[model samples]
Target: MLRPGPVEQTATATAVSVGHLHQVFRDAYGCGPARAFELIRLARAALALQRNHLSLAEVAAEFGFSSPYHLSRRFAATYRTPPGAFRRTQPAADAMWPVRQAGLLPLAHLLP
Candidate 1:
């Protein structure tokens, strides 16, 4: 519903020219680049939780979050749980791929 300001757009567009930024920008959606990147970092944090044991501050720095408190606040808003608690309740791996087989299968061969 909100648009990115000039500065945020420039930064995000710059990231788009890079590699993984494409996926991050595409997957992370919010009112602006900063918001989207925050969302991207959140998703990455969620992914990171799959293997790593780190505090909110650690995750925040790794993902460019402004601060641990900032990460905690937004993460609660997004996930409805604290990071540590959320990690404890994680579901099984097979549950992650999606119910649709389409999403589970790699489609790179059909892309070109």
Candidate 2:
């Protein structure tokens, strides 16, 4: 997970103390800023994997990984499968009818 370096400018721009900002982030995200950033990046990667025809290397580069190997290592650690294998096992669109239909439900009901 990438840790943002030196967010002093961000703190100043927001006019919030860094410690207070971190506390708010922790309260809202249930994790520190770095982990939240990692989850956001992984979500982007997941979306790309599901919707794009890009290769794993391309996906890694697209999502700001240092290299394909780095992305593979971290993705596997996080998801318990290599990205290639995960992509290969995704259900076809037609098979996702129930889940797609669930979009009609209220967003609050969809969340755990």
Candidate 3:
């Protein structure tokens, strides 16, 4: 069988639709690609909120969301709080994640 490249990976995220490729994503992350997308997006959002300089809209844009309002809606739905408020008031431990500086050592590791 031929191996798929990056675009195909995003296009067909479910194993039901893409065969073994979906399995690959699931195997690596222990979740379906769809779920993996949400998981990673939320994780990255948490890290971004820690900066406090960027608004939820900006964070959404930085993360490739379609729009600020869209980001606020989804982010709030998944996280159960508005992005702006969350940025203002998340617990330190939850806010801290492995951040990569110079592309080494994720900041998440620094958390207690």
Candidate 4:
């Protein structure tokens, strides 16, 4: 049997329609589920950039990004710095703190 995706599972668990779930997610997060999920993924990518010796392409692939360029675009948009620069400058241990300060940690509970 096919298992429901996260949004469908969330809707079922919360006893709400998928549309309602989307609306609720937007109201709470100021973005739809997809955008929120993207942000969460980017936040994790940020940590990986800081903490790992992986190349940008590797980091991008590991985080489900299409490519290093795509990762750079999203990372720059969200964190105001390219992933390469971030990786070079950020301390590994402090990676997630900046993300937390930027309000990305609210959805961290949804992370695997």
TM-score winner: 4
Regions of candidate 2 where Cα sits further than 4 Å from its true position: 1-6, 92-112
> Candidate 3 lDDT, tens digit per residue, 15-105?
3346565686566655555554544555577777876587666777776677878777877776777777777777463532222312213
Model 1: residues >4 Å from true position, as ranges? 1-30, 91-112
Of candidate 4, the 10-residue stretch with the lowest lDDT total is: 1-10
lDDT for each residue of candidate 4 in 10-39, tens digit (9 for 90 to 100): 789889998998998777767767667777
Candidate 4 vs. true structure, TM-score: 0.75
Better of 1 and 2 by TM-score: 2
In candidate 3, how many Å is residue 84 off?
1.4
Candidate 1 Cα deviation (angstroms), residue 4: 12
Identify the runs in model 3 with alpha carbons over 4 angstroms from their true place: 1-17, 27-30, 91-93, 96-112
Candidate 2 per-residue lDDT over residues 1-112, each given as its tens digit? 3234455665677798888767866776555555555555655576678787898888888877888898788777766668777678853423222222333223213323
Candidate 1 clash pair list: none
> Could you give candidate 1's per-residue lDDT for residues 58-111 as a string of tens digits?
887776667888777877777677777667787333212221222312321221
Whole-model lDDT values for every prediction: 0.53, 0.61, 0.57, 0.73
> For model 4, what is the error of residue 67's alpha carbon versus the real structure, in angstroms, after optimal superposition?
1.1
Identify the superior model by lDDT, candidate 1 or candidate 3. 3
